[model samples]
Target chain A: MTAVVTGDLPVIEAPRSRRSGGGNGTNFEMYAWIFMRMSGLLLVFLVLGHLFIMLLLDGGVQRINFGFVAGRWASPFWRTWDLAQLWLAQLHGTNGLRVIINDYAERDGTRFWLKMLLYTSSFLVLLLGTLVIFTFDPDITG
Target chain B: MQAPAGTLYRGREGMWSWVAHRVTGVLIFFFLFAHVLDTALVRVSPDSYNRIMDTYKTPLVNLMEVGLVGAVLFHALNGLRVMAIDFWEKGTRYQKQMTWAVLTVFVAVMVPATYRMVAHTFAELFGSTT
Candidate 1:
């Protein structure tokens, strides 16, 4: 560990540095790290709250039929809760993955393609999850 | 630690974490696809759907669910590690430390969830309250 002195304070520079010379401008990664901690904390609540409500409330797991889901989604509260959960979890997870891809993929082409694949799949899942929540029909008359 | 030609593989903590995340993500995607398809069976016929869900009561499905939850927990925790490495210049040095931290969190969160899942499956299978 090499320590760089900044005004009588010891600052350690991380090894395997990605700090390229010039024009790399801005601490976007720092902002992202902060975002993860914040989002992860929030996800702790949102995800747990969701699981509790869906799997534990009322008559517990037995009550989670199609009708129950439909009834809950009919309310704006559940819808918003679900929408927020969907967006936050997906964004947080995707951003986390993006950082992973950037850190590992050394080749320009490899990094680019891997990220492309990641983003594409994230978008598709988000779209499908949202669609299912919104367009779900409780009544299927037979 | 020699990497093959044109592999672009880095022998580092971050690299392994990335590989794991990608692998788990793909696995989760496949599980999600199968889950959605199975649930769609409900639209076909409720009786058949209940019969299908009966299969999930087996120990095999319970074990798979443990693996699925493990995957989700690992990917989420490792994703946080990657974020830390990217964001904090100081964090990159502690990559090995953070990798361990991620594993600790994964086990902590997943162990309980896996237990509950298995217990529920067992209760369903044998029809015993105790």
Candidate 2:
């Protein structure tokens, strides 16, 4: 890449450095990229499976009453499926956001505060989602 | 123009992926809010809830459903991409290739899934005979 030097007289060649680490290396960033592809593949299956069961099977959307949810959750199979989906989706999504925060937030204080906020919100959502799934009371009459 | 100090660009793949992640996250959050409110309507009255759900039975709602599913799939898959970037040392070299690969996988999985969702909704709302 070329850049304009001071005085605006001529274009100057940008310094090219082929060195790997400016003391930080590129290992972490590289690993994050690979994770995106791999997790992406898994998410495709988990998410699609979820949509199919929830939206298409049985009587479709019309049949998805409280009783239906209760029935499904009562089974270990459905519980495990839900648990896996919840954990995978949350971890994947949160980690993705973490990368964005690290890349964009320039100031240390900004980065720290933004990450703290992200972590807090992510934790809250994950906890609430898990709680609702497990402690869902089907019988509202009591 | 005088060149600014430090890195000019952090490359395209990372920036684009970051943008996509934020967009999808916002979409998912909006959908979750609507979903929770709609479901909570059931607490008011079953008849009211059914009426609310009947609104979702429409074609427009079905279209939104496609978008919703797409958002979830894209976010999840791209998230995996972000994770891979964080973990692998060689990931930087393959960032662009992996991004394309993620898009390919997303299309492969999403197109069929969307087709089925639309077809099922059509069948439910208009009947299969139509």
Candidate 3:
């Protein structure tokens, strides 16, 4: 197979995983791109439903309190719904920022640090959020 | 190193749209951070959660909510536009059209929502007894 060259500069193509950044042995960028699309679609429903229920529905924000939340969490449906929302939104938005940092940050050190921070914070939030959703006890009388 | 200049405004609609998408995306992400943190307060204590939420009921916070809604709606619609561009064969050729379509939908959805959100705040501030 012949290589096609379009630009003046000589081009050398590397392995997809290598070129895509310090990823594990996988087509991570392709998966990341696909994840963005899929998660964005899911997030539209999850987020809109959340906003509608939390801010725009019957009694609206005025009705939200600890009891309201405890009641909602009492149901498995809302627990799962909120869990999905937190995971999907956090992952999707974090990946978007990763792409942005990749595009804009000029230096390798800067990119590395930025991603380290991003991944660290994203992990913490996701962990904290998931734990909170599942382990919340409404009847802790004190 | 060359200093960055102000030619960002001169980019095509696609570039500008991408810029706006990135901006809105970042805004939503930060908001989500705060949102989750506040929501997590429910686990900590009911009074703390309710107190934090009550602060969000102010007119100032309500106005910010309108802005948040605009950001989220625009990001969602434009995200679809971006997905099309990435996945569809013909998407690149008609990106401008897709962007315009996104903007149209954004305005259509956001206007009524903004009106309702803001109007409710105004009504609450002025009292329903008037």
By DockQ, who's the top model here? 3
CA lDDT scores, all candidates in order? 0.68, 0.70, 0.85
Instruction: Give candidate 2 misplaced runs (Cα > 4 Å).
Output: A1-48, A56-63, A76-142, B2-13, B37-52, B123-130
Off by over 4 Å in 1: A1-27, A55-63, A140-142, B1-58, B68-115, B127-130
Decreasing TM-score order of the candidates: 3, 2, 1
Candidate that would win on lDDT: 3
What are the chain B TM-scores of all models? Answer: 0.77, 0.82, 0.87
Residue-level lDDT of model 2, residues A93-128, one tens digit each, is 667677777878999999999889877876776676
Docking class of 2: incorrect
Quote each prediction's TM-score.
Answer: 0.59, 0.61, 0.85
Instruction: Give per-residue CA lDDT, model 3, range A1-142, as digits (tens).
Output: 3344343653557544345555577788889888989999999898988887777776567678889999999999999999999999999999989999999999999999999999999998998899899899998542
Real contacts recovered, all predictions = 0.01, 0.17, 0.44
Tell me chain A's TM-score in each of the predictions: 0.73, 0.69, 0.81
Which candidate should be chosen as best, given TM-score against the real structure? 3
In model 3, pairs of residues that clash are none
- TM-score, candidate 3, is 0.85
* Model 2 chain A worst lDDT run, 10 consecutive residues: A3-12
Q: Please, what are the lDDT tens digits per residue for candidate 3 over residues B61-125?
A: 98888888888888888888888888899988888899899999988888777766766678888
